[model samples]
Target: MINAKKLEEIAKQVSESLPPSVKQFAEDMEGKTKQILQSKLSQLDMVSREEFDVQTRVLMRTREKLVDLEQKVAALEASINQQQPESNE
Candidate 1:
């Protein structure tokens, strides 16, 4: 999908006119441009849908476990308070 050389070839084959100054290298420059552009764009941080989905699933599972642990802690605290021996000096 990230092929500059193929793109430049296609551009030249599609273009009917080329300036004399660059007629000989129209294809080469176009290919080079395509590569540069693709490289730059790739360097930018971009996430795929699949990766995002996987991360989301991981987060959901973590949240569920956290909630369960919190509930257990609260129940234990309540039981401790109820059974605490009162100070009767």
Candidate 2:
């Protein structure tokens, strides 16, 4: 979930940009802005930093295993090719 304090800070910054005439409604504007920001942000697909990092590590490990398996297969194929010629002769 997004941080509430950070959302409030964003809302405050947005409200600060309002003209002097709208200063009387500063509280209302801030509240509404924060609500809208939260609503829209929640609707989007997002992942936290820790979750992304964990997935990255998982991918790295999987890639390493794939490379090892590929090397083993190549070595086995080479050995088979070497034996087939001697038997045919």
Candidate 3:
């Protein structure tokens, strides 16, 4: 989740950009802007940076294990092939 201070800062900046005539409603604008921003952001499907990093590490480990298993299977196939010719002789 985004930090509340950052959201407040963003809302303040947005409200400050209004014309002079709208200055009277600056506080109200800021609050509404913050509420809208939070609501929209929450509706998005997203993950935090930490969770993304953890999932990336897990994927890397799984790939490494898959590669290792593939090599073992290849070596076993080669051993079986080598013994087959001798059994035929």
Candidate 4:
């Protein structure tokens, strides 16, 4: 059976091997580095590639529809004009 004193001795040895200050400094450095990277990235005006692709597709579709509507309106106007007879009095 493993007694409490042996467990306490093992724990004491583990804690003694590493000083608390060094452990805290390592954690602090990691946090600061993460914050710096995040701040620098946020300053840039950049969209994800997916977002840019979506916008490009939407614009192309809109342009194509507009052109089709314009052609349809022009064709309708032409037909209406042709149906009306010109009278020379």
Model 1: per-residue Cα lDDT over 27-82, one tens digit each: 78999999999999999998999999999999999999999999999999999988
Instruction: Give candidate 3's TM-score.
Output: 0.59
What's the distance in Å from true for residue 60, model 3? 0.8
For model 2, what is the error of residue 71's alpha carbon versus the real structure, in angstroms, after optimal superposition?
0.8
TM-scores for all candidates: the values are 0.53, 0.62, 0.59, 0.47
Local distance difference test, each candidate: 0.90, 0.93, 0.92, 0.95
Residue pairs in steric clash, candidate 3?
A: none
Tell me how far the alpha carbon of residue 69 in candidate 1 is from the true structure, in angstroms, after superposition.
0.7
Model 1 clashing residue pairs (backbone): none
lDDT of 4 by residue, 1-89 (tens): 98999999998898778789977887899999999999999999999999999999999999999999999999999999999998889
Full ranking by lDDT: 4, 2, 3, 1
Best by lDDT: 4
Which residues of candidate 4, in runs, are more than 4 Å off? 1-45, 87-89
Residue-by-residue lDDT tens digits, candidate 3, 43-74: 99999999999999999999999999999999
Top TM-score hit: 2
Off by over 4 Å in 3: 1-20, 25-31, 86-89
The alpha-carbon lDDT assigned to residue 18 of candidate 3 equals 83
Model 1 clashing-pair count: 0
lDDT of candidate 2 over 1-89, digit per residue (tens): 99999999999998888887788676789999999999999999999999999999999999999999999999999999888766554
Question: Number of clashes in every candidate structure?
Answer: 0, 0, 0, 0
